[model samples]
Target: MEKITVTAQRKHRDNLPTGSVFGYLPRVVLAAMLASAAVLALIFSEVVRGWEATISAFAISWVVPGQALSLGQVAYFGLGTANPRGIDITELCSAVIIISPLLLLAALLLLMRRFKIGTVFKALAAGFLIIVLANVIRIVMIAFGWDHFGMAGFDAAHQGYGSAFALLAFAAGMIVFIRLSFGRKHKSQQ
Candidate 1:
């Protein structure tokens, strides 16, 4: 009779799936399912309903002083200005849209079994923070453009240059996730 080494047994267990479903399901299929579920949850959850206002307040405060955030309407107001130019933040402009896809991508990577769950989760967190910060910068840029120049400037920033920058930021985030999750391993010298 052969005895199994404790370390070898532990390694085998580590490679096994956490549940029976995960064990038998194909990785691609699992990734698709997880991605769909995550996106749907984010879309339907009230937990993030306040994100628009929160992001607006942060961006307004950073870009202009004494700017007040209005509730319900989801807009910002300038102090003492008769015709204060404010940006009305909507769900489309919120970071939720951008963050959702990135999260989906991360979840896909996790389910695909290319990387350890811990590593995927950490990278996902960092990527989310990066996306959120980029969104803030985009909002501030729009505000500054509107303040300095008007609708044309705002349009240029919002629809033209800003969109490109957003795409770049998102791509950079994806690249970072890929590098972190699939980084090359170096062989140790014997």
Candidate 2:
């Protein structure tokens, strides 16, 4: 049998498919397409519009002691307060909005040859879970603060603390994904 030289092996590897979408196309073209797709997902998010209410309902149900009742998109709370509180679940309060951008960024990363599709999927999955959990905690904090300390506490948690926490969680999740995707391993040459 003939021995294959390192140059020959390198050439063979170069010819093989990279497994990216439109890998045969120019990298710049592919990158632009992927970026545009990501932007479009945010622009026309019909599927994601109602997800805020659904996810909030599920999260509120999980956080509260009893069943958290949602009439339409509003979550009703306050057991023995002067009046029952209705927390309206809006796009700003939903995890789906935050998760969508991450997913799009992952797709862009895949297109730009930063990592494999499997890595992107894994990262996106983990990020999605984190975002959902963070959003739930935010809502809970707002509701609990409102019930206990009145409007000031609610505003502080909703406008100040909870929003910051959610943004931090999203950033942390994305950072983890990037590290997992691009962290290089060195192979010792014999």
Q: Which candidate is the best by TM-score?
A: 1
Candidate whose lDDT is highest: 1
Weakest 10 consecutive residues of candidate 1 by summed lDDT: 44-53
Question: What is the C-alpha local distance difference test score of candidate 1?
Answer: 0.68
Tens-digit per-residue lDDT, 109-170, candidate 2? 76655465666667667777777778777888887777667899789989999889988987
| Candidate 2 deviant stretches above 4 angstroms | 1-12, 17-49, 61-67, 79-82
Q: Could you tell me how far off, in angstroms, the CA of residue 122 lies in candidate 1 after the best superposition?
A: 0.8
Clash counts for the predictions, in order: 0, 0
Q: What is each predicted model's overall lDDT from 0 to 1?
A: 0.68, 0.67
lDDT of 2: 0.67
TM-score of 1: 0.72
